[model samples]
Target chain A: DAGVTQSPTHLIKTRGQQVTLRCSPKSGHDTVSWYQQALGQGPQFIFQYYEEEERQRGNFPDRFSGHQFPNYSSELNVNALLLGDSALYLCASSFGNPPSGYTFGSGTRLTVV
Target chain B: QKEVEQDPGPLSVPEGAIVSLNCTYSNSAFQYFMWYRQYSRKGPELLMYTYSSGNKEDGRFTAQVDKSSKYISLFIRDSQPSDSATYLCAMGPSQGGSEKLVFGKGTKLTVNP
Candidate 1:
């Protein structure tokens, strides 16, 4: 079975620009979550989309937003990016109410220049 | 203080040695614990997960959780070069109503031949 798939493996954007990263969740999964991992740090939770709506969010600012489609594909959009936003954006998928094991995609490397 | 604290160890050890990684969490509500392994620039791969205080063993890797002390540990036995990666400890409350995970900074281990 295919696992999660994320688009735009690598991206370089300038400060103040916007970027959209996409993800196709693993087959048989219906929930999508986004995370940001800086160099030498673990992935930090961004937000999670369930039932095509955001069900939970972390401490990220409003500049970070995401959407989930009916097919369980998701997109993470960052507006007015800053250098600190440069990191590996990861998309993970699972199917359950809570405490499900997440299958993660390779992730998109966002470089804010 | 950070919700999770871990020593970001670039620990070097010889092949076949036992490696221990640990993380301490400050959240008392956390009940679900997990360990993830991540290679450079790659998303984290779930290693093992345990709920509450108990010992879980999967092949050469073992996970232990001490809920009373708010501490968790991952032990790798007969370590191999392939086991060299950043090990992250993640936790969340089982009843907190979301799959959001708080993660540690991760411990980097290098097993030499």
Candidate 2:
């Protein structure tokens, strides 16, 4: 009955440093996707994990990567953070169904200093 | 041009008024449409979704997708203060092949009592 959950509601990192954000998908869901939402802008797709492998990815650079565990929990890692990397990191969970809508977790706010 | 475009309005309205939110997409391949609501500092919550085209209503919210014009809309009736949030329009092709929600810059709505 629990919805998608994310950890480290807020984080701060400096240039050249890395940060990892965690997410636990909603119960009964298997696919996990990560998004980055900047202030005053909509989210940009980072990547998606299904069957413990990355299935699809967006236009993000190599600095962004993620993993999905067997339990359906996922983590997003960003390296060499820049000020532009500061944004709200959203974790959305969905089944592989065609019409399935994603259930989102309360995002982790990353502040690159 | 952005794949999806929306007016980032701090749209203000009175309680009980009808509110309309909209988005336009340039990608013709996008068939699954969705609306998500995000409160400040929170991840987006799925409001409603429509596959292909047509209208889908849930309680006070209605989502309309017009694929011909590549436009979509979300209407809120009898709006309440709790409805005040950033409404995001997201769309992409169904999962299993391409699974990502290309989102628009959210429209912020404020319903006053």
- Who wins the TM-score comparison? 1
lDDT of 1 at A10: 99
| DockQ computed for model 1 against the true two-chain complex using alpha carbons | 0.79
The ten-residue window of minimal lDDT in model 2 chain A covers A92-101
Q: How well does candidate 2 score on lDDT at residue B9?
A: 91
Report the first chain's TM-score for all candidates. 0.97, 0.97
Error of 2 at B98 (Å): 0.8
lDDT of 1 by residue, B19-58 (tens): 9999998888887899999998888899998978999999
Q: Candidate 2 DockQ score?
A: 0.91
Where does the lowest 10-residue lDDT sum fall in candidate 2 chain B? Answer: B92-101
What's the DockQ for every one of the candidates? Answer: 0.79, 0.91
Candidate 2, residues B1-113, lDDT tens digits: the string is: 98899999989999999999999989888879999999988889889989988999999999999999999999999999999999999998734459788999999999999
- For candidate 2, give fnat to 2 decimals: 0.95
Q: Estimate each model's TM-score.
A: 0.97, 0.96
